[model samples]
Target: MPAATFEPPAHRGLLTESIARRLQNEIRSGAIPVGAKLPSERELAVQFGASRNVLREVLRRLEAQHLIEVAPGRGSFVIDQSTADARSYDALYRAGRPTVRQLIEARIPIEVEIVGLATSRATDVQIEAMRTANAAMIAATDPVVKARADLEFHDTIAAAAGNPVLRIMLSSIGGMMFEMMLRSNSDPSIAEPGVPHHPEILEAITARDTDRARHHMREHLSLALRTYGPDLDLSLDVMAANHIETLLHRRSTP
Candidate 1:
């Protein structure tokens, strides 16, 4: 992406969110390609016509969303979607982000099969990864980390399935899935009942019990549809958006 062309929405003064979302679109679309390095902070400020501090704030947003990895001395780089998978359908989500219901619909069928395959095919390391993610989900106090961990719990299963096509399909909706997880996991009441489902599913998979794994996965995924209702993507995300607003404010002030 080019610099010095950052356009802020007319109603907003600071360009932090705008610049972050702009980069998010490019990265999510694979325009920057996985593992590609981003422009330096100085370079990005020049491109966006904002301060280096504002640009730093923008990078934080991307990091929180898990779209980029910022190494200490090295520059930021796009993280791979599916490490072993070949093709990506990330282009499909570029036009507009999918709603929670649409994303869950796409995920349930694919993940259900993915978990079944994973039950039979998962290696020791893969199972350990699922265990680690579940522990993190239970421990997370921040919404961003909670959402990321929640997604990781399922993603480890997809990777373990050893089916590249199915894994790539599951990864295609990751951004929206993060949004869905954010909504459901942020609220204590809605999030509580669903907590044990991950461990149950993990236990079944570890035992190589395919039917049990699928049953738990289906139930875990189904709770959002009923609990979230029609405006889930909008309302619950408002709580998440408030957190973002807090970050933006803290970032904007020197």
Candidate 2:
């Protein structure tokens, strides 16, 4: 017997990138946890209405980022997110430095979905743990303390997902996620007492309403993203400008 050759699909539409974006977003959001097998290239192509080639290219890019791995005689497996291979896992955001838009946009969807899943799977003990973490967040006066507490809250929810692989995937970039939250929450709006939304999310999860859990989690994220301060780091844009300026500065310098 001989092995079957891999056949590329025949269609590549302008929508290929959009499909890729949706898939990547899903992976980051933990709708597809780490170490889970993705659909075959042919299946993905059909699903996205693109050619196999485009789907393969998208998977290749994700693989390059260590978001997925392909093996001969097998299918693509999301890298074991639990591995925490710094060399392999790239934090979705660079810590202490990310655009306000980037921070909020990236963090919201992922956390929202995690809460939704948690609503269904979290044990009573898990719910209580999250409440404890939230209490810590509410009591903290310093940025560092608040940040740690916030991480605890989200980490607890991720743990409640009942998937160790999902926790690992969430953990890989978990540090950066908290850092971004702190940065975005520098505004007075977030600093006010009773403003943190973790409690609302925990309440929803305890109530076991997946829809409410998702909604509150999203509201929490939306508030963070919508809130802003003059101190918001525009460094993302600054760095881009500086890179060009430095290149020109060097070009002009005697």
What lDDT score belongs to each candidate, Candidate 1 first? Answer: 0.75, 0.64
Among all windows of ten consecutive residues in candidate 2, which has the lowest summed lDDT?
Answer: 1-10
Error of 2 at 96 (Å): 13
- Model 1, span 79-177: residue lDDT tens: 975543422444345344455566667778988899999999999999999999989988976666777899998899999999999888887777567
| Model 2 TM-score, all chains together | 0.53
Which one wins on lDDT?
A: 1
Misplaced by over 4 Å in model 1 are 1-19, 22-54, 57-91, 94-97, 232-254
Per-prediction TM-score = 0.64, 0.53
TM-score of 1: 0.64
Expressed as tens digits, the lDDT of each residue in 75-94 for candidate 2 is 99876544566234443354
lDDT of 1 at 212: 99
RMSD of 2: 17.0
Candidate 1 residue 117 Cα shift, in angstroms, is: 0.3
